[model samples]
Target: MYKSLRTFSFLFGYLPVAAMNLKKFQAQKANLSKQEYDALIHTEPQKWAKGIMARTKSRVETSGLDYLPDGPALLVANHEGNFDIPVLLSEIPKPFGFISKKEVKKLPVIPVYMEDMNCVFLDRTDRKSAYKSIADTVGKLKDGHSILIFPEGTRSKGEGVTDFKSGFIRIAKDAGVPIVPIAIHGTSEIMEKNSNQIRPGHVTIRVLEPFSAEEIEKLDAKELIEKVKTTIETEVQSMAQRKADLQ
Candidate 1:
């Protein structure tokens, strides 16, 4: 209970002030390229997220960053916990946005930051809006900003990865970009599994090699999705087993 309260207090206390500063920065740098603007806006939020993870005593280890190429690409990962976003933002060297649920756009302070990062919001219940969101994401990718998508559509709560929703493949294909598969393990153990209370834990994020546009085009959509899904799941299960062995 104390940890939850502390986490909430820290987030609520810091965000509004941070949002104000970001808005000033945005207005002053209105002419910056989208990528430049996003990197600038995300600087503080990334720092804040890393601080929060530290406060919770969570350790994040990332691998295979060298495999991420320059320019635009689609980052697809399994959904495991609420901490996944922060962990990625804090650790991943690239400055990128995400495909977030539309409801997140309604949250205080956060929406501003996401917008600054060029994030696309999807309302799954509304097919029209969802499709529009996907189009917007593709445009961003083509514009040279990397984007992250969970593909699982929702968190698995550490039960193990769920089957991915294949629609995001359209973004990569449409943008003529590569898809980088990422597998994240042990995130839910930090907070989601125990009623959202923050705690000490270790998280692993592994970035697999990119599937180039040429490579994606060689496979049918089903084959492509299955290939990426299998790659991520294989790594996730291996990481989970390693965590269990340490325990």
Candidate 2:
């Protein structure tokens, strides 16, 4: 009963904070141009995420950021917790965009805000729509925008990454951008797979080296997917082992 109350209190507390942030975002939206709006949206979220991570008593470890070069690249990471996206978006020092589900477009005000911030949403159930979305994402990359993709399509419920889907590789190839594999750990434990109550925990993000577009161009889609999956698995395992050792 106490735990349930705590959860309820947390949700109530977070909702208002989210609303205020959104309100502020809406008020400021018209003052910035398209580029400025994208920049602020990306940077402000990182600040908000860092504050959230700090409040939740989480810590992040990163590596291989130097591997990201100037201009555009595809960032692929393992999704474990719902919090992972905000965590990554908070710290990654690049003007980046995200590939999100089309269903989010139905979200009141948020989708309009996302559109203003230049997020690309894909409709999974419609083949033609998905291709059109992919083409739109590739165009954004061509316009020199980096992007984050969880090739696993959804969050993993436990240790180790699920088999990667090939769609991201297709996106990277079509966009002519390099793929950077990022491995994240501990976020699931912070909020768990199905729960919403945020717990104080540490989350580590391991940014592996970027694989150049030129490098993967010769490899088939199947081989490229395996390579990124292996890299993320290795780093995520290392983080898990490190957490276990500390315990």
Candidate 3:
């Protein structure tokens, strides 16, 4: 209970401070272009994400970063917990944003940062809006900003990965970019599995080799989705087994 409260306090306290920083940034940089402003402001959230992991006594070990090619690419990963986004934001070497739910746009300070990061908001219930969001994401990708999508659409919360929704595949295909599969394990143990109480844990992020645009084009959409899904699921299971062995 105490740990949960501590985590809650930290999260709530950080918001107002983040909002103040955003205000200051906007006030002092009136002439900056949109891209320039986004690039400058993005560092704050990256730093904050790292700080959150550190404060919670969590360790994230990553591998296969070399597989991420230069230039804009689609990063597809399974959703595990709230920490999944933070972990990726802190660890991914390139500057990128996410395809988040449209409801996030209604949030206070967070929406400001997300918008600055060039995140696409999907309205799941609105097919037309979701398609528009994907088109917008493709535009962002073509503009050289990487985007991460949890193709699983929702968090498994440590129940193992669910079937991925294939709609996001269109972004990479339309943008003529590679699709990089990422596998994450152990994040749920930190604050999710134990009822949102922050705790010490080890998480692993594995970046699988990417499928080039040509490769993606050669495969049917369903095959491409299954390939990525299988790749991540295999790695996740391996990581989970390794963690278990360590214990």
Report the number of clashing residue pairs per model: 0, 1, 0
Give the best candidate by TM-score.
1
TM-score of 2: 0.83
Model 2 stretches with alpha carbons more than 4 Å out: 1-37
Q: List the residue pairs that clash in candidate 3.
A: none
lDDT (10s digit) by residue, model 3, range 18-85: 98888877885678865566666777788778777777778899999999888778999999998998
Model 1 C-alpha RMSD vs. true structure (Å) is 1.4
Q: Is candidate 2 or candidate 3 better by lDDT?
A: 3
lDDT for each candidate structure? 0.87, 0.77, 0.86
Which 10 consecutive residues of model 1 have the lowest summed lDDT? 1-10
Clashing residue pairs, candidate 1?
A: none
lDDT of 3: 0.86
lDDT of 1 by residue, 167-238 (tens): 888888899999999999989988988877778779999999889989987779999999999999999999
Indicate whether candidate 1 or candidate 2 has the larger lDDT.
1
RMSD to true structure for each model, in Å: 1.4, 3.5, 2.3
